[model samples]
Target: MSTLTKQDPFSRLLESAPTNFTAARILAKECYLAQGIPLAKAEEYKFTNVGKKLEQNITNFFNADSFEVSEELIKSSIFEGFKGDVLVFSNGKFLPAHSAKIKGIEVSVLSEKSDLALGSIAKPEKDPFAALNQASFENGIFISIPKKAQILKPILLLFFNQANEGQVIQPRVWIEAGDFAEVTFIEQSVSLGETAYFVNKVVELKGGINTQLHYYRLQNEGKPVLEVSNIESDIQKDARFTSVTISLSGDLVRNNLSFNLLGSNSEGNMYGIYLLNGKSHVDNHTNVDHTIPHAESHELYKGILADQSRGVFNGKIFVRQDAQKTNAFQQNNNILLSDDAIINTKPQLEIWADDVKCSHGCTVGQLDEEALFYLQARGIDKMQAKGLLLYAFAGEVLEKIQEESFRTYCDTLIQERLGSKF
Candidate 1:
């Protein structure tokens, strides 16, 4: 039998907790105990080795140690000098002193007192990471905007993993947008001092009538790190929500994203880009639920894997019987740099409404040889030719980035990965 078949640390951790009152907590425990570490036997996780790695390193999974987050360190982590309401957290604890509060914006630190309310807003019952985050995390940032309020500037939620002594750290963050409110939020993760850490994060968002939200997440952790993130959002009538995830770093990473269109005329867009090299592995699984009529959703995920890295994309869209006018579309595309690189792409649509329009498709292949040949024929070196093609392949998604600075910044990073200059 595989070692992953043994008891899981998450299982033991939850069982040891003093009290478990919520259904989510109970479900988390049950899922862990029953599945232990996901392995090849678990069809859903068959293409990845996350379970095996966790089992081998299970001994030191949650080792907590003290670390510091200086102002200089926080400043250095910001992207290209653009700043707004910044909230800094170190080792799973919120640093109010480092947080900046803006006018008309409400931000608070979450505690046990807000669990029930958060649970209701978050709907932890559906996501395992959300449940685990609720049970393990003590302090986090809670952001809310009043009706018709507009956040002129962006909000940056920075999470610094300073577990220099090599411990597991969990970060839970919640964001709420009231009726007709508009805001752009950014979530960033960074680790310093070569620490071995695990950051399990949960993000909950809500969009009210005519509201709009833009969420961007960038994950950059040190080598030998494991990170799991779950983001769930509920959309009301005529609201729109867009979420973009960019995974630039981490040894192993998984993102669970879900959206429920509970009101008619609501819209949701999910976008993700994962660049992996060496033995790194990244997985993105997204679900879009159409529970009402006239709801629409669109998902596009692209991945680039080099060397022996692996990527996985699983997207599911569901249209309920009452969702007669729902329109949903999903597509996943991948590029493999080496023959040994692997990618598993699965796109599914489950529609119970006959009047709905839904379509899903996935593609996994190497860079276009014709494009590479054309570039090389123009006197460009083979390496440069390949890099150019890669840039163009990812350019489709990069164009969707609204902010010029962030878009250019991402292009430069992608160029570096493609062995070129932007």
Candidate 2:
């Protein structure tokens, strides 16, 4: 780990990191101490400046071991069934009453007894956010899926930042899929009040040989909330991993997603859409690393920024020396509905393999005036025409959502963003 000078604010935060005699906890603490809050002005974080905001909210959020949960609040948060597939957390504490047990999968609160299992795939020492999660998280979910078992329904991990006032909350989750296993995981973040709060979350997943893992992450934290989330996954031979992230609303949201193709013939697909308004800000940074032959990865992200909102998309793809016959593609498209809206996007590729084929590009354009005019030449009104064109532009990515219920839910949010009644 690189060293940080005394002036760095994160250095002070490391001094207060919780200490434990366990090796896992010790490694996490040591990582944070050695490299606090990433290097100052690092290129990877050129657009998002989160170091100060993290320092401001770290104290009140990390120290407390517990908080209160409302039964009514929990019920209202569930838009779907209360079956065994739901896992509920409020202010980073898991609630057994709201969470039901599912069959064929082992889900337990992360404890010292199984610290070794938690960090096998997700290395906390590699990233600052991961390190903080391991060092201080009070409760987290450790999930293991058996080989050859396919769960038809998607498991939902719901989080609520209730009664947070101005405090920040951090939650951690780890998931492992056995060979030939199939599973879908969804994580949704929402809030109930207009009060300002912050959430720092960490999640790590690994797919065994020939496994199938589909992950959907939605950040619809209503208003006056800041969220910074990190997701890391390792894909094995002949395995497949699909990630769909939807960012509807937030004061400030940053998603750090990374996928490592460790085995031959592995595949990864990463897609995202963000509908932003107000003075909100959202940044997505994704990295896909291919280490073996015949691996493939694709990334496509789209954003609709209006009012004074801002959006950022940065994607990096790495092809190792041994990763021959690799195929990779990356693209980011954005639309700015207002003059005040802003977007920053970059598509980067680092290849050490000469036989691989890779391409990357980004597009930032306003709503097509010609298309809107053509629609208005018909019977549609101006506002309706604008809405229609924006929807069509965003429809491609939206069509890829596999779950019907989740797709409809995202449609409702996108309609709300477009000021549509439906």
Candidate 1 clash pair list: 63-167
State the number of backbone clashes in model 2.
0
User: What is candidate 1's lDDT per residue for 96-128, written digit by digit as tens?
Assistant: 888897789777776543454565555554545
Candidate 2: where are CA atoms >4 Å away? Answer: 1-21, 38-40, 55-65, 68-71, 80-84, 420-422
If scored against the real structure, what TM-score would every candidate get? 0.91, 0.92
For model 2, residues 1-422, the per-residue Cα lDDT tens digits are 23333555444334555454256766877776766665337666677766655555434443234456677766777665324278888777677677868899988776633534555555776677677667666677678899999988888898877645656577878888899999988888767677666677888897899999989878888667778788889999999999999888878888989999999889999999998889988999999999999999989999999999999998999999999999999999999989999999988999999999999999998988898899789878888888877777777787777877877777777776675442
Name the 10 consecutive residues with the lowest summed lDDT in model 1: 1-10
RMSD of candidate 1 to true structure, Å = 2.7
